[model samples]
Target: MNNEEKYKKNIHHIHDKSYKDLYSKREVALDLFKNISNANWSKDLKAEDLTLVNNTYITADYEEREADIVYKANINNSEVVFYILLEFQSSVDYTMPLRLLFYMCEIIKEYAVNAKHKKYDKNVKIPAIVPIVLYNGEQVWDVPNQFRKMIYNEELFGNNILNFEYDIFDISNDEKLNKDALIDLKNVTAAIFLLDQKMDAIEFLERIKVIALYFNSLSDAEIKAIKKWIKNTVVDPLAESAIKILEADKREVELMVARNAFILDEMRENAKKEGREEGIEEGRKEGRKEGRKEGIEKSKLEVVRNSINNGLNDDIICKIANVSLDLVKKIRQECEKN
Candidate 1:
């Protein structure tokens, strides 16, 4: 795929309300801490300090902002708070550190504004403010996809040792994690990395299906919705895997989905949720809202074209896109017209 098409595939979440509950849930921090490397998260504030209260806040800031998920966690202890700010970049961000620095400084000024720093040394009494960059783009991350140089470099050459100030996790390419870690993390980890990398959609889908089957009891239409997203994402590279599992037991998936009445409950709840968000946001941004609806449809067609290229089953693409189930029946008509 070209750069433009690939960009949309990896980073469309900022515009999609379909993910409202995923990041907003209190469990997101836990999942990211568990799956992402070198992250040790605690619900108990396991530090040598305060009681923990998990919190979240998000903003469109679409008009002008550097983050999609802007939040603060109240890690209470000794009247000292750990202030954190977060940003999720589906594409390479050249100005990320500067943006993070800007936000971090605001937290400091905020501390001073509240008179919380009174009678305390401005140099010592301030709480720690952390800014994190969760990079999920497809580049090496040494530089932005558009630019080719480091923005600034303050050389600290002392005793023949060099110290670079930037700290980043260039988790692109195949080094993200092994299949064992993916399976151990179950669905959430699978979703995070699968979406991050240009992994085969079919393989991820089949894995998600099995995970869905295990928790087939746990996944509601949400898994099905995620499947729809997986299908919308790309051609089913693991189509054979899904078919092998399905053909092995015709009634297995049917029974599993049925046993979990949770899907139906979720469907109803989702309908209400979708209506509320769509009504408010969609009404305000009709052009973008309709553009997305149309874009997903077109992206689905692109995936079908990829399936035909890969020699996979083209029968399910339309059904999976969920734009119109009737599109499946009309595939021959659509395919032949061109």
Candidate 2:
């Protein structure tokens, strides 16, 4: 696989594991919710009351896409569902609002089906849904956050149109995160997002230290899991090697030496690969051009032979077939000999 595809796969794996293992916990999920929603709703919520629901939703066509997390919680004495969409793509998806809308619809539809089987009241209302997008992409998300904002003639529809806006926690821009106030798990999550961005091995090691400090409360297994995740997802060979080495014990100087060596090796390999690909592409283009030119020349020769058989003179055949007089005379001699 190409480097970009490998990076994307690693990101997906890390996101899947982190959200399932850590963020699915009530305390961690609640902290993340509070940070994204900017609401003081945690005091009212008991950890036991928050339930993590299955986030895999199938569309009408039976195609499935897994959401990061879906939490069922009681907020303001009413049932509310939080749909957390973890976006780890390098580029911003402009259709995110529509995509979230479809997911919400599917969730509501499933809830309705279950309610029917339970024989709930016909007048029962659907729970409020809070769509949250946690994006750690390289590019800033510039798309509109609301479903209605995506419509071209949204203003013309006025109040009759349906619209919902999702909350976004853009981790690419550090301004969005309150680094000081975040809990340990949330801080670790932020550190993971920051690690996704481009950074040298030394810088990565420093970030790892910050994550390790916050990870002190967790079990050794948990720390090991995070380290393994770092090793897998990091694109830089030096960074990956450093994580593997640093996991056993924090050795900064050794990590730096490994990183420097990795950088030189990586540069050489990348240059060689790019040169080979360019050369191959150029060769293919030239081959196709030559083949086409030869085919056209062959076709002209056949036309010249046919003209000679049709009793056309050499001068006329040369003009008609767009060939030189000497070439037409050579063809005439070959035809006469045959």
Candidate 3:
């Protein structure tokens, strides 16, 4: 099946547990929020607790309110607990905040009904819902990296109320972080960042050792199946789909590299041959122009001078000039003397 298909399969079991854990704890979300938290993700956040979390969660959940992943954690003296709902996606969802609010409402209704059905359970706390988005897409989905703009309203009179009800952490796929900084992020986050680099899809996926290792942790059967699919869909024949849309661009880049190498090789070969021919011609002409002894000497000097000016390094110039160290030194001395 395709990547989108696999994503929609509800095979949460296939997802990395650490990834799930990070989503629940908001470590990844918080890191991203430091850069991209917006107004939409914080609708129900009453005052302060929604902004931070550092405590033992009562329970982590995924089956709550039809969200992709949700976690119920206890913080704030372990008394005031809240829900941290996380959504993981390859593309952006425009209706996320509204959807999350509706989901929160549904969760409240469910709790109220459940209390009625229960034998003896205390009143439902109506815990706050915090939604975070982990977006991985080629282009940005939202306008601002943060979602603060969504909740604010500009009134006609003076400054209206400021509403930052929710928080969102959009790990921009296109944004490139340095290797050192990338290494510090959660391994999967780093893997996703690396995957966005320009490279062959097959090689790109292979280079992500963490992602591969995480998947490989699955059963042998699951690994075998994933390998087969990747081989066929990503690496084998159709594996070239990564650059399919950008075929011309890819070809142009390859051509540039090859073209440079070819031109350099041609220039070197031609220069070598030209140098030898020039040396021979000067040797002959000098022999004829000057007396035999001086002519031969001038020819040797000409060879040495031209080789030096050819841009070749000293070692290469010496080899091509075919002059001993002493002779080269003498030629240089003679030139300086003249």
Which candidate leads in TM-score? 2
Write down the RMSD of all candidates, one decimal each.
14.9, 18.5, 21.3
What's the C-alpha lDDT at position 85 in model 2? 40
- Give the lDDT ranking, best first: 2, 1, 3
- Using lDDT as the measure, name the better of candidate 1 and candidate 2: 2
Q: Find the candidate with the highest lDDT and give its number.
A: 2
What is candidate 1's CA lDDT for residue 297? Answer: 50
Report lDDT (CA) for all predictions: 0.46, 0.59, 0.44
Q: Which stretches of candidate 3 lie over 4 Å from their true place?
A: 1-67, 112-125, 143-165, 172-180, 186-188, 196-199, 202-206, 209-338
Per the 3 Å backbone cut-off, how many clashing residue pairs does candidate 3 have? 14
* Tens-digit lDDT track of model 2 for 1-338: 85445644554566555545656666656655553455554556655667778665535542322335677776555554443443323346787788778778878887888767444556677776777777655467787988999888999998888899887767655464544433334444555565554443344555565564444555454455556556455434444554654454544545554565555445434544554555555557777556555555665676677656644444445655678867877787688679
- Per-model TM values vs. the true structure: 0.51, 0.58, 0.38
- Residue 206 of model 2 has an lDDT of 55
For model 3, residues 133-226, the per-residue Cα lDDT tens digits are 5554435667443333445453432335433344443444334453445544434345444443333222342433334433233343433333
lDDT of 1 at 312: 39
Error of 3 at 150 (Å): 5.3
Question: How are the candidates ranked when ordered by TM-score, highest leading?
Answer: 2, 1, 3
Better candidate by TM-score, 2 or 3: 2
lDDT of 2: 0.59
Query: Which scores higher on TM-score, 1 or 3?
Result: 1
